[model samples]
Target: MKKTLMILLATILVMLTGCGTENKSGGLEISKDVAFGEKDYEKIVSPANELGFKLLKEVEADENNNIFISPTSLFMALAMVYNGAEGETKEEIAQVLHSEGIDPEELNKANASMMSVLNKEADDIQLNIANSIWLNDKFTFQKDFAGSNKDYFNAEIAEIDIADSKSPEQINNWVKEATNDKIEKIVDSPLDANLVAVLINAIYFKGSWTNEFDKNETEDRPFQLLDGSFKDVPLMAMKEKFSYLENEKFQAITLPYGDGEMSMKVFLPKENSSLEEFKTLLTHENWTAWQKEFEVEKGTILLPKFQLEFEASLKGALKSLGMKSAFDENANFTKMINEDDQVSITNVKQKTFIDVGEKGTEAAAVTGIEMGITSAPINEPFRMEVNRPFFFTITDEETDTILFMGSISNPVQAK
Candidate 1:
């Protein structure tokens, strides 16, 4: 009788311990511990840089038009879906993400770490990143995939009736809240019935310049367009010592924000050089070299007061980047649901907003990865004026991670 009692006690203890290890809701287990370190950051930066440039190149192919994109937000959304991919589908995504050697588990940990780091706040600076997964209430998801996202991305998982009219509104409301209302809506139309899941990532950033431009100095100035035409724009002018660099092709300057935690780096191509021609020179090696060339200098600077909003469907771009399988019928997303369900990515979309003025910069971006279908700155002390088309990047100073990138060809027509 004593031996039997001891065996029963041991079994009970084991069951209780297992229960504590996994957090569960609606019959799904969620992971609670996910972390990463410096090595993971090193892995993340390479892929981010590659994707940023590639997207820029594609968006600029139209030429003579303003373009903006948030590669970081897009990456976060897709990385969540990547957790549910398998076989060649997985391999293709890994390759496009520049995460070839890293496993999905490690990728999640890295993204978790990155989000934590980027979202850290400082006086007068606000950075927020939020993620969510919305699932069709009638459909069941693989436990591991949902749990991994919850554990690593800190994503909110919601089971909603997709057939209901309020479903898209709920998702869009979450996105609006996450981005501080800069992006009001991501899902412009109703979702399809075949859609099984929608994964979203939204980011909001508001920072004051370390040295705010004086509103008194603002004046209407001529902004040259790519077509050799010029239009008057509200230009913010100042003279201050700033981080500056220049070479044969372009002159670049860094405008620090919020105690130097983040910055806008602008690259203005030399006269007679087209912005498109200069873009082709944006390689990791060249970017590193340019950073090395920055030195403190005092000169006059003139930049436009501009606001912009941009939206795009990224299916074709991702396909061109070697992630074709995820959208095809044969795509293997077995890890997300029952194998017989036959789900593939249907669409991927992003929306972004930015405002730059004398006080500082406020920017927001939202990226939605719908697996349902299975699918800048400038300076001048030595007198640098942003009178024409130029490229810019908003980045974290500590990690050198780029959050937003774009080109302004005509400031008068910025939006």
Candidate 2:
């Protein structure tokens, strides 16, 4: 009886934890606990960060608001959606996502492994990533598509009655909870009639500066804007030994958070050059080079304390990244559902919030990919798919993007 009870208890524990499960779907058996260490993390940095840099330029191409984005959140959400993508749609997404040369199974495991490693949170800082898929209760989606994301991304799958007036709130509430109320809502009050599924990824982070600034030392300082104008802002002050870099175009520094496990890199464009000009120089090669240029030096840093909440539709940006097919009404998402039902991404939007203050920094982001009913073209498999000095980013590696996938925030563009 005792032995039987122990076995029963163990089974119950597995059920509750949602871990150590065998993930087999679409002819691939994925390992739940895939290995992703510093070296593995480094190998994928170029591809992972390449998209974020390009997307940032595209997002800011329209207007210069205090820009902030979570490449990880956006990538994870799209990666889930990619499972159902096929044909040209899949290839475009793969190119834009920098997933070339990586097979489907490997992509799933890499995302899963990276997220798992990041979630091994420490006591001093908090970083959380949540993914989910909400299917229209009336819609029929591919079981394998749903299962792949569930197994690899650890997504919470649900069926929502779109007719229900409270359904939008239900989805928003998850965003609220996932972001610790930092983000209150993601979906609109009246859900779209064409909407079939919404794939979402939310990230919340709060961390204290390793070399914290003195609250009392904060003073009003003149800060430069991208337009060459100056505004008086409350600037936080800290003097200490830190990694500092100097280039002809910009000067940069690193601000570690939570025992140096992660950090925010800050860059300031040289007086002769403007933030606008420096932004144009943000190539993948430059990012890699900039990461290595930082040498430890004793310096006093003055940083402005600001907050920004920005939201925008990423349809344009995604399309700009050569992912136009997925957004088309005739997009081939056959792997996600029957071709007759037809589904494609009608909208890809993101909402991000950040507050940098004396005690610490708090930020949240939510990316929602809205799918609508369509007649998809049939084919093979599933599909899916930066800073300013005057920039700040928190990533696992300057090259590899670890901090919940790479995060870029440049509130310094304060108008």
Candidate with the greatest lDDT versus the true structure? 1
| Residues 1-415 of candidate 2: C-alpha lDDT, one tens digit per residue | 1110000000000000111112111122223554334334344457768878888888853264467777766776676767888888888878888886566666776776666556534555655556667777766667777777777766677888877889889988876666555556767878766556666655445567776778899999998776768899999998899999998999899988878877778889888887768878888898988888789999998889987777777889989888998877547778876446556676777667666766667666666676666433466687642234333345766477645533345444666
Global lDDT of model 1? 0.69
What is the TM-score of each predicted model, taking all chains together? 0.78, 0.77
The 10 consecutive residues of candidate 1 with the worst lDDT sum are 5-14
**Candidate 1: Cα lDDT at 127:** 61
On the 0 to 100 scale, the lDDT of residue 8 in model 2 is 4
Candidate 2 versus truth, CA RMSD in Å, comes to: 18.1
Model 2 segments beyond 4 Å from truth?
1-43, 61-65, 375-415
Q: Name the lDDT value of residue 350 in candidate 1.
A: 63
TM-score between model 2 and native? 0.77
